[model samples]
Target: MAPISAIALLSFSLLSISISLILSSNIIEDLNLPPPPDFRSTILKNCKENPLIRYCNAVSGDISDVFKSTIVAQHLCNESKNPNCSNSFTKIDLSTRPLIAPLYLSFTFFWKYCPLTILTIDLSNNSLKGSFPSDILFCSQIQSLDLSYNGLIGEIPTDGFTNLTNLTFLNLSYNQFGESNILRLHYFARFNSSSFLRSGLLAKDRKFNVGSIVLQVFLLIFVVGIIGCFGWRCLQRPDLLPFFLQRKHKFTQAVLKAATDGFSEGNLVGRNKRVEIYKGILRDGSEGLIEIHRGKFSFESRRDFVEECRILVQLDHKNLVQVLGWCDNREFRAVAMRWTDGYTVVEWLSRNPQWKHRLKVLMRVVEAMCYLQDQWPQVGCEIRTSSIFLSNDHEPLISKLKVQDKNNPSKNVYKFGVFLLELVSNRSPHEGFETGETGFVEWIKIHYRHHVRKVIDERMKTTVITFVQVKQAIGIGLMCTDVSNNQQPSLHQISKMIDRVYQSSLVSQSATHRHKIQRTPTNALKVNGD
Candidate 1:
């Protein structure tokens, strides 16, 4: 009876507890994101330095509390639902991934929350309107970072970023990064100019050639036979004169606009849903290609769009279409790439209807891809026929390289296999799937050994190609299309394999030609006389 009474009281307490609780309808409301007043006060108290205080004051009105400012910092920890200090500090794991640490998290708070276990800090693109942090370098455990896309006004830390060998991938784009100290990027190993990108650093240095500026303006006015060019400018206003002179400079809206001739429709050379390509002459009198953003893009905000273009303009590789500079004014936005003559890859392939010629062109494309991959380890985008362009000399050039989330090297290999199939079959990737017979990879697997020859384009069959060469190409393609990255051959390995076949074909053709000459009556008489 006593035990029953005790159990009944406990049950009653549990029932009371359950009845007292009331769940709110908006459990995921905005106010829930920020911490209570005590947490905010604690964060503010910890931010002792002048820079941190200035930043806090600027952002305080935006967030309900300090917790709102720490979204990116939360990702640094494994499960930081509430960033409260618990442990006395220790070293962090350097192998952990770097994140955007664009917050005004103070060193005091850093130790409190990080607690010796946090591997890295991230505060990128947080609109931290202030000077740089005073003492973040005290965190010995921090390996990598991202202080990019902030408005922190100052020279980069004199301490340098390469102090930690384990650190990789530091992006400082779109910030007021330029000061007298920042001469070149490689000086800071972890933060480079060309790779993930360092924009605005070199904008002041691009120094659009002055000599070419005068020549181009002269060419523009005289060649068009417009004597009123000076009068036209004078009538337009005094402001227009300075604009024309400085158009020869970079990182300005007027520069790109003048280059595109006010984005005229008559100069339009290419069109797409997202971008418009226009042919134009740069301030240097050299022809240029302009890619204008016409519609909504992958960017979430205008800032993101500007940041993306800023990064893109910094990349330079022989294989990559040369991105000279960009424009991001209030209304107009564009990216300028080096102009090249001739047709897209489709036209080149259609004109040169030979298997050997096509193979060589494909090899050049592969070489370009390999270079791109080597220069930027993170680059692993799809390689399609449409993305490739052919110069007048038949030089294959990759027109674009868009970095995306799915950066598995195997993805590129798979796309290459599809490209190979297109070249061999002379059919688009979706051409055969209309009847639902099978997908490209599945069809190839089904006809691997038997009736494989039937899939080859009838035009390609005219050439006396070796069975081994054809089989090698087909087998390589099949392997590339495999689901597993481990199973697929690397681009370097594929290049070697292709080169082997190409050399064999060259040797075989030469031998056959020599045999023909030896058999000829005129050659036989000349040889006998010798």
Candidate 2:
């Protein structure tokens, strides 16, 4: 394994070169072409400092231009309904990437970023020089790949290529890839023998040497050992793999752009200024919402979003909004969610003016908070009605939940207390307090005790059931939000307390009505006598 200093030096050395040196022992320094005219440091920086790092420079001419073309093509393709649009949209045609410079293949880059939407890649005429790209193992969605008339070298990898089950068309002509029959790809059987005829099949036949075979076997083992070491480091500190490689489900920029109309202003329904929310309709006729967090791409931002996606995928709950997938490319980055038919808590309150109707919503929201506490503890503890959605079934779901810095149970309960205050009063949290920082529990302590009725929402038509329920719900909110205690009650305990208080409140309402009916029986007695 290399030391940190060695890795740094190697990183810089790789940065200096336009592409990775091919794995051939026979070096050809004489084949070097002159650098492009009017080259600037910014051009090099685009490749070197890119989120994909130097992989862009290693592949095609004018690294920035290549990324722009691909991203724009995604937008156009997402807009086009025609299946044959690929013939008209030519920038994404990998077949023509290198007219000026030798194309160094970006196996790793394409493998990591290519969504299922991309089906074909042709680098047939480019002067690409590299070993048979083993990185195509990640490109399982690709149905066609052409790499003919290139200066590629090395024996073709058989084991890795077997993953590309969808490959129906393949061409590898006029390349320097080795004719080692022992290393022939069995997966290539999907294509006819013509695919490899003028390429590796008839290229320079290697002399048989037992020592050379032994050397190759040892080298393979050595490479595997180094990879294992890096895998171990990745476990210790997760950033090593780059771009949060664990995120498997990805939406193409084209699909997202089409769904969002290139994130048009007309489709936008909500905005916090930090993030814009747009309504989207996918190609499959399903509807969704797109949350595009405003920011340019930084390595950390990309890593964080990918991490967020990974966590969102694991969480399954009726109260939590369903995350479909994510779209990330040079053009846009966002999280896609299944659109809800219901409104925000504020809007729902206006429509459902009955006190009893709102009480039912409060109970469901409590259950969701308790679940988050039990599963992730304090990680997603922040609560507000604005962050919640009422689905068509009248269930609540959480959205845009960020990772918290500290696991403060008291703070979470305090927010829940304010959420209760909002529901009981039919007012936003901002209206309850003069300042946002002041907890709602403190406002309750200062004002509400004997005059809880004064604070209950007057807009709602009060009933016997609701009057009792509001009193009990506020009581629970106050108790849960008490930060004076050295230790706080577990969310499980708080949830049960709400359940008991609510049931008793319902019983009180039923008993109150029963007594009222019994006292009014005189009229019925007189009617019976007549």
Candidate 3:
């Protein structure tokens, strides 16, 4: 009797266990959960098959709340309907329960709806921290993504959304990833006008509509056609091609790396406050130089590049350094300029101490500045000593001179004259003696009133410069640098004054020679017989 009783108990226990297992499997299947195709099925199946994940159907008042509680549960509970409940989750009410870290639940759901037209995994307002999962790349059909307001860090990996080629709306803002890496994903959107996702959720005007789409398509077609036509035209009429077009250049990064020999220390050409210039050679054996402006990669940098290009193109002058073109690509941002084989005026003056050549160079620079001021009245420009360069043969030149008033209607000639003074005296406009705290112009006026020698270049001590010539130049420089803008002379007036100074110097020298001849001794005199 005892043996029979023990056998019955064993049979009952076995039957109960089998019934429980069958019910659990049925419940998991009935849940009809989705699965992420790319992630391992074992992981997905385990999460889905877990009794905790099935509690939503048993006791769910709200689906979102049930999922939230289950997500934070300690372990799978067979008896309790709310197995994953936690006190922390009770205080927080989330719009949607995004399976935060152990992402098996979300992964399964994604795979099950494998061909979903748009899979929006918006976990915003959740205050979730840590880097975004690498497995997100598996969502091949995800057309729109809103991962904003999360505490995602590190880089938005290039491979993060590599498979999400169909993506249109991508919002990863209000996060910690650096903006520099954003360009890596810029090409993901289609060329269609409607393809671009407008930034800022609140910006109603930013959204792209059907009209925008048509415009975008038209623009794309237009651009492609123009590029094709340009290439064809260049092939037909080679002479029409510019220097940059003639030489097929690589992308900015490749060119920079090759030119700098992998950015080696030896390749650094020059360093300024804003940029570092480097010498580079293109694939077609064409020599070039590039300036790497200091700024982090962002939308602002993109805008600056456009502005810089516009400025360079408009202010075209022979004396100024020519901007060949600019490059704004994903990995590199730089400006390509014509490489001038001339030393700076400072270097040239230091090497060649000849006063005559220095004077000639200074005059040439003055002439260039004066010409620019006269021609481009809209561009009130200035040429400093630093802007001047001297050729290998010690011929003076000027380059990289910028316009002071880019949008001014009337010309400012006074500023041009002040620049000439700096070039002539080898003194900065701010330096030298002032008459009444006005500046270099006032200083020049004081010197002219007193003595020319005080303001003249010391190198001209042995060389002759007439008082009249000095005074005229000083007067012109003062006129250019006058406090009142209208008091400045016109370019025509400036040209006349320069001519007068030259004539006066010649006349004064001629007079001095005649005086010397008059004072010659009678024994040394040679008589010219008629």
* Alpha carbon deviation, residue 420, candidate 2 (Å): 1.0
Error of 2 at 501 (Å): 3.2
Local distance difference test values of all predictions, in order: 0.57, 0.61, 0.51
Off by over 4 Å in 2: 1-248, 437-440, 463-465, 505-530
TM-score of 1: 0.49
Evaluated against the true structure, the overall lDDT of model 3 is: 0.51
Q: How good is model 2 by TM-score?
A: 0.48
Candidate 1 residue lDDT tens string, 1-530 = 22222112112212322221212222224224444445444444334322223224533654333343232222233232334322211222222222323323532343322222444555566666567664555443466565666676656665634444455555566665445325355556445454223333544422323445777998987967765766565443332555655432234555556767877888898888777889988756788888787544443556665655555566666556777766655555677878988677766666645666666766776776677667765555456677777777667677776645446677777787877766666666666576331386677777768987766765564445555566677787787788755778898987887778778777877887898888888755665568
Which candidate's lDDT is highest? 2
Each candidate: RMSD to true structure? Answer: 30.5, 30.1, 25.8
lDDT of 2 by residue, 1-530 (tens): 32222112113322333443322222223123233343334344444544343234444554433333333333333332325432332213456556422322332333443434456666677777778766655556677778888888877776666777777787887776666543244555456667765465532223323455778999999999989987765543332345656334476665666788888999998899687899999544688888887557877878777777777766667777777887665546888888888877777777754554555566776787777777866347346777777876677777756556567776777677677777776666476467652545566656567777766777766566667767777777676666677455556666776677666656776887888888886776476568
Report how far residue 511 has shifted in candidate 1, in Å.
2.3
CA lDDT of 58 in candidate 2? 40
Better of 1 and 2 by lDDT: 2
| Alpha carbon RMSD to native, model 1 | 30.5
Worst 10 residues of 1 by lDDT: 5-14
Error of 2 at 12 (Å): 81
- Candidate 3 lDDT over 1-530, as tens digits, reads 22222112112222323343324533334234322232233223333444223322323233332222222221211222322222111111221444432343244432322222224444454555666655555556666666666666655565656767777676665555533324424564343323222322212323334466789999999999999998776654443566666533224555556656776677688897777888876444566677777556788868766665656556556565566666666445777666768777766555535444544554555565565555654433445556566667656555554434363322345555665565556666555545322566666677767676677666544335554455567677777677565656666667667766666666666887998988998666866741
Ranking the candidates on lDDT from highest down gives 2, 1, 3
Residue 328's lDDT in candidate 3: 69
